[model samples]
Target: MKQVLSGAITMLAGHPVAPSTVYRLLAKAGWRKIVPRPSHPKRSGWSRRLKSSPRR
Candidate 1:
């Protein structure tokens, strides 16, 4: 948030939307949290571990 706000502030003073604010607004709008996929999960051994791991 601070980063975004800072960027906005740098670009235009007065009221500025910070990066954090954008995330907050998205959350309010029911946006899901983004999770990056594990890198090459299909080709990694970690994928097998994930499949074998018991659910919590």
Candidate 2:
């Protein structure tokens, strides 16, 4: 996000933008940090097991 914003600022304003400034601006815009979660173990194997299991 910071890199993209920095590039955009550099392109538009002819100056680099600080990461802290980008984060601060996003915070003011009500954006929150997101953490990605790994897929659930059972769900991951469901399709594989279904394919390998004997057909009814």
Candidate 3:
């Protein structure tokens, strides 16, 4: 859940299931707070350290 909400990508992009389907599942499972996080407030400019590196 944290990975999905980390701003790297949308839930649908990370998960094989559709975004709406995941959302509905979460809702039905009482996982309301498991949604994506909004854009960061203070972070400005792309930081090299924030980028995800290719896994070996």
Candidate 4:
């Protein structure tokens, strides 16, 4: 959240918009906060985690 806010501030530095205003604009544009969770009903996290493990 902080990284996104910081980038917005840098991009709109010359403007008089506040961080809150930038968030509002983003929301208006259909941006949403995504909560991490299984994208499918049958997707198990343990198998995915094991597959992502570093090979030794």
Q: Please count the clashing residue pairs in each candidate, in the order shown.
A: 4, 0, 0, 0
- Tens digits of per-residue lDDT, candidate 2, 7-30, equal 886688777777787788888989
lDDT of 2 at 45: 77
For all predicted structures, in order, the TM-scores are: 0.33, 0.48, 0.31, 0.39
| Pairs clashing within candidate 3 | none
- The alpha-carbon RMSD values of the candidates against the true structure, listed in the order shown, are 7.5, 6.9, 14.9, 7.5
Alpha carbon lDDT at 1, candidate 2: 68
Q: Candidate 1 residues 1-56, lDDT tens each?
A: 44754676557755766566667766787877669886665677877789889999
In model 1, where is the ten-residue run with the lowest total lDDT?
1-10
The TM-score ranking, best first, is 2, 4, 1, 3
- Quantify how close model 1 is to the true structure by its C-alpha RMSD in Å: 7.5
**lDDT tens string, model 3, 5-28?**
433335446745555665675677
TM-score for predicted model 1 compared with the true structure: 0.33
Q: Deviation in angstroms for 15 in model 3?
A: 10
Highest lDDT among the candidates is held by which one? 2
lDDT of 2: 0.77
CA lDDT, candidate 1, residue 18: 56
1 or 3, greater by lDDT:
1
Worst 10 residues of 3 by lDDT: 2-11
Model 2 worst lDDT window (10 residues): 36-45
